[model samples]
Target: MTKAAGPSRRSERSRVAILRAALELCREQGFGGVTIEKIAARAGVGKPTIYRWWSSKHAVILDAFMEHIATELSFPETGDHLEDLRGWLHSVARVLAESSMGPLIAGVVGAAQYDPALAAEFHQRVYLPTRQTTIARIRRIQDEGRLPDLSPDTLADLITGPIWFRLLVAGDPPGPDYVDTVLAAVASQRFPASAGGEALQ
Candidate 1:
């Protein structure tokens, strides 16, 4: 006899359904419209099922938002570290500029200002992983003597800060050449050394 799928599979399905529902609702009605009850109804699950997994609507929204950006969060592998970084930044800026998730992200950022718990959760779940991964790659670039002897954290900020400024403060969407321009600016400061062939660590 074939073995049946276990409870873990069911749990996984339920979790995916909940998150998918959350994303759909947030897209249709914005983050403010998402509620545990609505998500449960859309996912055809009980409210208790969502409560079992997440602490609140804010937490659920953050998880759903993380799921939405999962693909974009990976470090690209394009042979050149600066090129890879530029590509990732362009991809992220495009997402923030064109996608519906952009508004959701902005709303979350605003909400996080007043909600310390949400801010903590965002740092823990979203910011830290991406930052650490990018910083690790930057450290590898620094070790190869391509980049300056800057801290990895500082490098990450330098890379992402302008993108966020364009997205939030400047209110101007990054043009296609934005990444190339940024790369040029960084490359201008490149240390004179053999700084290639370094893979992500």
Candidate 2:
């Protein structure tokens, strides 16, 4: 790297180091416990360096989570829409099963209620992808003329609601039977058509 490039590269390295440390700390300590000073110490950088890059510990950890869970967050593809839904939902459940992620996401959402900035980033970065994926799958069905037309938003919600409900309220692990039902609902509209109800068979 040239002299000009040297500083930029160093900055990038420092930013990544801080993000990595912050993620590990937050995962190990829970959302309520991690701090900037601790992250700085863990990353071997000064507190000022961390403060210069990220507005808060939340931002740093958010970026780290985006990096670590990018694959898991993505809906899996198997050339079958129902299978895609099953794999995607199971991927979500598996992430929640992690000791760290469930609490981190729940805590972030709760905090975002008080911090508008955090709330905005969380929705933009994390919430939107899963929702859009659900919609895309349904839209593909519509394109294929296999299902009645429906709003993408409605379809996304219909497919994902059960999983979120089970996650937040029942605190339950959804079994294959439940996944089958969800997949079936997508393949076959079970409710009124407004709910994007369609039967695959």
lDDT winner: 1
In TM-score terms, which candidate is top? Answer: 1
- lDDT by candidate, in order shown: 0.77, 0.73
Model 1 agreement with the true structure over 18-130: per-residue lDDT tens digits: 99998888878877777899999999999999999999988888888888787875668977876677678777877787668677777777778888887899888887787
Native-to-model Cα distance after best TM-score fit, residue 89 in candidate 1, in Å:
1.6
| Clash totals, every prediction | 0, 6
For residues 23-139, write the lDDT of model 2, one tens digit per residue. 778667766678888999998899999878778877887888888788886877778765676787777777766767776666666677887877888888777765666777777
State every prediction's TM-score relative to the real structure.
0.80, 0.77
